[model samples]
Target chain A: MFYAWPFATLLGRVLQPSSVVDTLTSPGIGRVIWFTCWQALVSTALTMAIGFAPAYVVARYRFRGRRAALAIITVPFMLPTVVVGAAFLALLPERWHGTAAAVVVAHVFFNVAVVVRLVGAMWAVLPTDLTAVARTLGASPARVLRHVVLPLLRPALYAAASVVFIFTFTSFGAVKLLGGPSHPTIEVEIARRATQLGDIDAAAVLSIAQLIVLAVVVWWSARWQRRSEHTFAAGRTTRRPRTRSERRVVAVVMATTVAAMVAPIAMMVARSFRTSSGWSLTPWRTLGANEVRPGISLGVDPLGSLAVSLRYAALATAISIVFGGLAALTIASARRHGRLLDTGLLLPLGTSAVTIGLGMLITFDTAPFDWRSAWWLPPIGHALVAIPFVVRSLLPTLRSISADQRLAAVTLGASPLRAWWEVEVRRLPGPLLSAAGFAAAISLGEFGATTFLTRSGRDSMPIAIDRLLGRAGAVPHAQAFALATMLFVLTAAVVAIADRQEVVDARRA
Target chain B: MLDVRDVSLSFGGPPVLQRAALQVPTGDVVALLGPSGAGKSSLLRVIAGLLVPDSGSVWLDGSDVTHVPPHQRRIGLMFQNEQLFPHLDVAANIGFGLRMQRTDRATIASTVEELLAVVGLHGFGPRRVTHLSGGEAKRVALARALAPRPAVLLLDEPLTGLDRELHDRLALDLAGILRATATTAVLVTHDHDEAATIADRTVVLGADMT
Candidate 1:
């Protein structure tokens, strides 16, 4: 809808032969598309390289500090892209400023969690019996990995790759902050045209193109996943003693993962506390101060932005629980003709957030659904993006509920509704709570699409930090550092709480 | 009485059972003994209404129940794993079937208490299933399946995971429980001794049972 009128106008203008030729032969658009693909591919490969060995180690071995390593790998995934970009900026040498390598490195740093969590979790569940059988048949360790492990791991690996590709393909903040003019991704181009040039037509075209690319990638990945079929034996023992080679591999993987995961975060922490005079608490103190600008009477307060962020996060979490819970229940109960509904629920996870924000802008900016002027748009947008995660986390637990319990209840003379309540609904507390916690964390850090929907003076934490970083001053930069630190701590707390709940549930099971 | 006539079942690409027939009179404990791959479990599943036979008819008490779901058919199934709800306590597990039937709280509590006594698990209601020893868990699973008062009970290798002493004792106890309750059951197992001890009649199954 955002592009309808502009496209029509362009079509009208291109009715002339000369204009039509120009439109068909634009070099700038082609360059943007080429650069977008290049950067996304490189970022995905680098992320997998950094994440795969560690994930393999975690899945295959039992060692000290495994839990801590997993936590560190997942922390970046929960962080807002703007915060991660800011951390990278603070950490990278100023000499390598405005380079493609910087953007690729930042993308890798942010996406390591995706590869580890998705691939590593599935790898851990592969049956040990398959490997044992292959070894007993005299297959070498490397051969077993190639023939036995890789075949089974293919589906999960492809799924993780598809996810990482979509995220990098929609690269916005990291590329904008770190990329040179020669390496602008399509997402960065879209943002620039919409915000700086106000070329809504160009931005819409780029967004539509991005959506098409993502759809193709997702389709290909789904096809690959469906064709690969192998089921492992259940109830295989997972706690095997590690051999010497396994021990060395695990140790090396752990060291590399820890270094890659912790370096940028350590850099951010150091920068937050550093001062010209000495290491000081000036940044922390300035978090509450409001510095007035030249010729402007009012100054934006960092604390005020923080409060708005908290309010939005809370609201988004509540909305996600309500809407996402309904969607999950519908999928769980729709015994027949449920495949379409399930696919619809998962569609948001693959679509780019920026494209969704653009659609919302086009659909709701006027007429019967004029939500542009309302304060609810940002939270609603965040909820739409967070629903997919909630569904993914809850669906597995729901599916695993045994059929006997429900039947047992019904045969005992209970009505169907009563049986459902007693058997399934009563057991949903663990997954629901954890999913809500994750949605809350996502809302707190979300920036990509929220940037498009947020009205003037209604900046989120990421937006406020971006504003502070853009201005040239010591106090603003310090305040931005402090805000970033606060955001980090808030997200860390949410993740830690969710992690504890998961551990408790696992122990109980 | 429960009857299965010319039942067939197949998985993804091939048939596992073809035109299998069986009958159980009321209060009869029949054992279906077979080798590992003789389709005993599949036949049991078909009778329990968990799997619909490709083409067959099922009758319970002279009523056609071929289209009924497992819950509506009033059948109880116990797996070799003692598939107790890990989240629920012993008492809760026993009362789960009754609660599903929406029995009144007073009745549920009393029935659970009676079953716990019968299983020699008095005062064990509050303990979590994960804490139970192998023998205790198997008993709890049996109590759970029996609490609902199903017309027919299905036990799939109920004693497979127990040690020899526990298995022998539980088999005897189980037979006594079935006789006391006058419940009809179909026991599926590979152990001839277990079937001999617990069943009133045993049907040996082979690859060509169909």
Candidate 2:
């Protein structure tokens, strides 16, 4: 009901007479779309350039703080795009704050970790000896990398690039906040048409257009990722850099990536501390206290928003783990229908949150199925976004498990489901916990959908931060920064735990 | 011809290879035999330019190639696990070295076909390496290593995991292939009988080699 009902209503509404034809003929919709595509392409290219070097260094050579470096770089990926927007707005110069360049930079910052994790995982398992063998066969180091390593890494590269492209293309929160009024993307325009302008028909048409484009990209990327999948036993053990040049390259890449990732976040935190007179923690201290100010009140306290965010994250994580685990298990075993379900689950990832929120509002406003007033509506939205992450994390571990173990349990008199539970799910506590942590991190920072579903006086941290920044004054701006900092710390903690669990799972495998 | 002079290496443990020295004349097949942990594979790696020895040098033909990168060394080392590129087919794996040398397509094709026949994988050019059985993969690995006709080919326990009957049969087949190619090579193995059967000459390194 949560996923299909909204999506069905969305498609039904979009298919109404003259809806698609009218939207397609509308002026500037093409420009919004064209701008979206080119900017996404630019952001994807920049993310690849920035992420590939660090990924290669981390995968190929072991260095001090290698894991820590990877963990640190991924922190930005888990932060709310609202926080990301606020950070860039604060960190960029006045002229650069609300430019297309700022939007592209924030998108790259948010999606670089996707490349690092996906490409690095594949790179790590690749047999290093293949490269050595190429070298010994008279290929130069450059030729070996180009012919041998590049060909082998092609699928993963395409997969990462496509995924990053899809993410940047469907981006909502960052572009809307950072791209400013003049630089409206399809997602931003869709939101404006739906909520601010109260034109649901136009929004439905835009949503349908966006979904069609996303379907093609998502299918292509998934196919490439599937093609790249290998069953090789992980053999390449990382070692210290063999030459001074190698050492230098590793140092430069690591230093640059860490600085780029950390600087904006550091600026955001520093902004929270600075008052009109001097540096102070007054904004943070008054996070809960509702002292009257010149700007917007937000009605809900910041601390209350933090607690609400945690509660939603916890609820979303629980939902994601259960649904994601069941979906992965079915996909791993079932033949045709399971495959369709697998693709269906990932549709939410490509679908813009604005569309989902609008779909929910239109679908569930009636008497019988009115979930619009439910406290769990936002968590459901967060869970919809988070389930994909949980599934992505758990599927590999589930597939790696042999089926004979479950069969053995079945032969010992356990029911089929019970056998699978004992053999597969019970033995995967580490992966389950890791998936849950990832889901929690994703839910904790989710902003795009939350912006629509957040009830007044019941805003999540991201919604509260967005509201505080929406108000025009020094106090509200400072409070937004403070809340963003809190989110940064919370997400960092969750990601740290998740990363350690991933490492443990990799080792165990 | 290849030479290793007084090579020493340790991974913060008791030195795996201490003052290890060996020499083989052109077209000579020499086997280095030792127990498990005697660093026979390490010695082969040091000679193959995969590992740099602590305080010694490796000479290929006549020049010192101690610091040369593995590719520039023009040497081949077949690891114990074969490590065939799973992405390529059998013929492509065999022709990889020739292609790296930038040989013409026809010549590479003919050479690969000849090597496949010699490895007894005739007409298996398009077969994926993952489908090859244990003994077949080993033979393909040998063919691949010999394709470039390196100055020295290093084999580390190539038959270690095979059954005894298959191991002995492959040892004899390998002996015939090595002699036929006239390729100077170093074979590292712990099995006495297999080494004695395959190598023209054998050098046994003691547990406490100085």
Span of ten consecutive residues with least summed lDDT in model 1 chain A: A1-10
**Colliding pairs, model 1:** A409-B100, A412-B101, A413-B101, A414-B101, A414-B102
DockQ of the candidate models in sequence: 0.01, 0.49
Model 1, C-alpha of B55: deviation from truth (Å): 64
Can you tell me the CAPRI class of model 2?
medium
| lDDT of each residue in B123-169, candidate 1, tens digit only | 99899777889999889988988888889888888899788999999
Q: Write the per-residue lDDT of candidate 1 for residues A347-442, one digit (tens) a residue.
A: 677656776676666567567778787888888888888988888788777777777878999999999999999888888888888988899888
Query: What is the lDDT for A402 in model 1?
Result: 70
User: What is each predicted model's overall lDDT from 0 to 1?
Assistant: 0.77, 0.84
The reply for model 1, stretches above 4 Å from the true place, is A1-27, A125-144, A180-182, A234-246, A292-299, A367-369, A401-420, B1-210
User: Ten residues in a row with the worst lDDT in model 1 chain B?
Assistant: B79-88
**What tens digits encode model 2's per-residue C-alpha lDDT throughout A191-296?**
7887688888888888888889989887787787678654455667578886678899999999999999998998998899877767878888889886536574
